[model samples]
Target: MISFPFSKTPSVYLKGERLFLREPQWSDYRQWANLREKSRAFLTPWEPVWRDDELEKSSFRLRLRHYSEEARSGNAWSLFLFRRSDNVLLGGITLGNIRRGVAQSGQIGYWCGAPHAGQGYMFDALKLVIPFAFSELRLHRLEAACIPSNLRSVRLLEKAGFLLEGTLRSYLKINGLWQDHLLYSLIEGEEQRRGLSVKTTAV
Candidate 1:
């Protein structure tokens, strides 16, 4: 009963054992907005300030459009994470700010709904996407930054084979304040060195 992209579209889709990552669709507005709104308190500390209309239907439509364009242009790939068992929307992850040429790298960011926070769903999604980035996208490195206090994110990146690179002061704005972030990176082949393998379904 799991539904996926019927054919190769401009946007890419990746599937894993327990979850799938795919391009965001406008019809997902209600579920996306509801989960985000309910998880606001749990997520706010680690996220940027939300606009007044951040979760409105109109805003979601615009966001969908942007994800489409980013995927098409090779600038970024924004994907929604869904549970495979029931297709429940679990969270979102973006491999964005892609750079080509000499620097084959991109930045990654992700979030999970509060109700699903402690589960390993996000971890599964990462395993699915990393191979797509390294093998299919043919990128050499992936980077991520997280607030120092966001211990969960730090562990997740490390568990996925990313090494601690350093820190950046006032690196990003979050929850209306400029914050310091610990930077991490994963290079090709690092996964195997760390005893991790990227599992993914072809797009």
Candidate 2:
């Protein structure tokens, strides 16, 4: 495990065996743009409609600003996953829409570059994140929703110890249409009960 100060804004850097997760940086614009551009077709079906300037540097700057505000306010933690061996950008994961007080929950969302899909990188990333959400963040629950047709996501969540909770009709607008989504959740003690071992350093 490695640790170091990240940024002035609230942020995290998580190190795993094969990869690491860190807040998106201004210097990452080119890599981010390249990955997203190449994976656009593969990802569009599951994501919101993209803007014409979605890959432009200005739009990326705006995204970073929004991410900064979310982190500063403790509303979310957005991180980009990178392969540690060669430092290649692999994907991104976020814990968003965090609720505190009695609820103490957050929603999890992620996207992987097309080239990296179905390669187990995300599974490793999720293993690292689940523990952080439950232990470091001290959250009671973490939730995720995916369209029923997205079997890959369904399997990833289940493999990460998230149980199928129920379904939400018209839950989110994806690819320009409202779609039904299967909801899944993992409680604080559930992962351990499911025999999950996650070890990562956060700083």
Candidate 3:
């Protein structure tokens, strides 16, 4: 069973007014695949082409191994975002590539279920996670990269108190093509002082 206020595993379930974040587990395979399959059309335009082995149990086994490694190294927090009221699987948010010796930072990456786009749930989700990253994990900064054309994600980061730092030319490979990304970052302990509070947006 999972415990709370604990390690990077299935510790406390983070709850917001509409959603909660939980650690991924074997039981989530079906729900995760369903949402991912349904979101393919919407996601494919921005994500890499799916490999034939992506959904196999063999792949999942590898994933579990990687998840364990990431957690043990304190280099990532991979979570499943779910609807609080009905427990629907919405999407996932990953805080990856964490560094601590000098640069205590991690990159935030996320995707929403097809049915949940254009809603502020992602932003609310970020709000809750950011504080936890800073306070609980003692992170110094968090960053996200968005395609220049992804106005939605860019706006979401801005609304969540991240500043547009710069752009990375051809920084990522998406849908089989190299894409540029606009970088956004927020330093720990600064958003509140700047009068920036997390706000909600609805579809």
Candidate 4:
């Protein structure tokens, strides 16, 4: 069964054709750890250096607690990607840094397991999440930043209708070093303009 820690929230699950976005559970620690470990080398260059206890159950519990607060407060939603066919945990996607009122926008970040890379799963996940960001979350814009050298990420964002906004010099620390990133943004209804099907249901 799908479990949402933030069960009181009206928007807890987002469903798509092949994958579903759901809240992460403490029981997912083993699968999450194994996938991250196998994808460490493939993921490190684009992500922060893993802490010594990065895969520990205690660390994951802390992470879940922090994000649970973020979700309930309408500040962010950090969801794990899972294949609906067999309920396999593929990776994660986060719509963070949410701003409301005058500036209705949020930034998105995502990753896929090494074995699942290049399989268009992230693309499908983005299709599901973007609509939720715009409709359920009532955000007007979504932003993403990626290392310039990470061509796959750049392509994924562009293919999903995000426009290249510009470059952010020394934008974020990745794998222990400051790295520049190319900024991308997608406005409300931009995906439709780009001709990508946005078929999803949020409940």
Candidate 5:
């Protein structure tokens, strides 16, 4: 069954034609660890510090606890982006720091394995995420930050219907380094979000 990261409501399951976005389960640990291990060099550049156990089986429970809090409050969506054709793990994407009420906004962040980096997977995942945020969570805006050096990510955001909002200087620290990032955002009624759906696939 699909599980949500938020507590007040359930929006745990989302799907696209060739992809499925769902809550992560303990069974997913091995795959996640393998992906991270194989893509260590590729991903470590953008990741935070990790202890040896952070990605271990023991850490799954701690992650579950954190996700439960996010689910209850509608503050986040930590979905595993996977390919339906072969059940291969593509990457992870999320809508974090969600603020409801009058703003109804949240931020988007994502990463894909090196082998799957340029295959349009992230864009496809964004399509489903946008619908999940706007339709299921009733969020009005989605924001994303990317390092200025990450031209690939910038293009993906553009293809996914996000507009460049501006730039933030040293707004975030990644891989232990503070850096400037390009900011992008998409509102609920934007052109890219017009036909957004959880059933949309990355094919």
Candidate 6:
């Protein structure tokens, strides 16, 4: 198992060669909102219906508060992806619904700005975060579910070493409709066996 330095902050920051993952900050509101606004049409089909105020600054502050609470309580980790060279926001990724004790597991989810999709940024971010999930978080397994029609997501998970488990019938409400999802999972040792490695620093 890989070892990571302890962080005094509520959330850990992950740095990779091409990009980095850090918890959202108040200063990120403008970039985040702009990306989401431009990608709304691209993302809405696979995501839940957006609230009326979804892109408003007030809504963003609420989201930050919720993220902070989740991180402090160890319930989840929410991070935004940024290109290392320019520090541009690429999108967001999350490790949520964490369970401890008998079930040391969590679910993974991610999104990319429309402009950044299919450019391999999400994959790089996954290499960093997946190892952190297994090593630093001590998670036994990680799960992800996506609409069957989202071929890009399917490929991403498969490439990242998540094995397809099965189909979930009407698993989640996406874009205002309850839709079936393809379930995938990766256990702790599986990722290492795939030879996935990326040097990461947590701060």
lDDT of each: 0.87, 0.92, 0.80, 0.88, 0.80, 0.92
> Which regions in candidate 6 have their CA more than 4 angstroms from the true location?
1-9
Residue-wise lDDT of candidate 2 within 64-163, one digit each (tens)? 9999899888799899999999999999999999999999999999999999999999999998888888888899999999999999999999998899
Off by over 4 Å in 5: 1-11, 192-203
The C-alpha local distance difference test score for the whole of candidate 6 amounts to: 0.92
Score every model by TM-score: 0.94, 0.95, 0.88, 0.93, 0.88, 0.95
Between candidates 1 and 2, the one scoring higher on lDDT is 2
Give the runs in model 2 whose Cα sits over 4 Å from its true position: 1-7
In model 4, where is the ten-residue run with the lowest total lDDT?
1-10
- RMSD in order of candidates: 2.9, 1.9, 4.3, 2.4, 3.4, 2.7
**What range of 10 consecutive residues in model 6 has the weakest lDDT sum?**
1-10
Clashes of 4: 0
Pairs that collide, model 3: none
Please give, for residues 3-113, the per-residue lDDT of candidate 5 as tens digits. 433444454766777788876777888888888878888887776766778778788778876776787677887888889899999899988999977899999999898
TM-score winner between 1 and 5, please give it. 1
lDDT of 6 by residue, 150-196 (tens): 99999999999999999999999999999999999999999888998
Cα lDDT over the full model 2: 0.92
Considering lDDT, which of the candidate structures 3 and 4 is the better prediction for this target? Answer: 4
Which has the greatest TM-score? 2
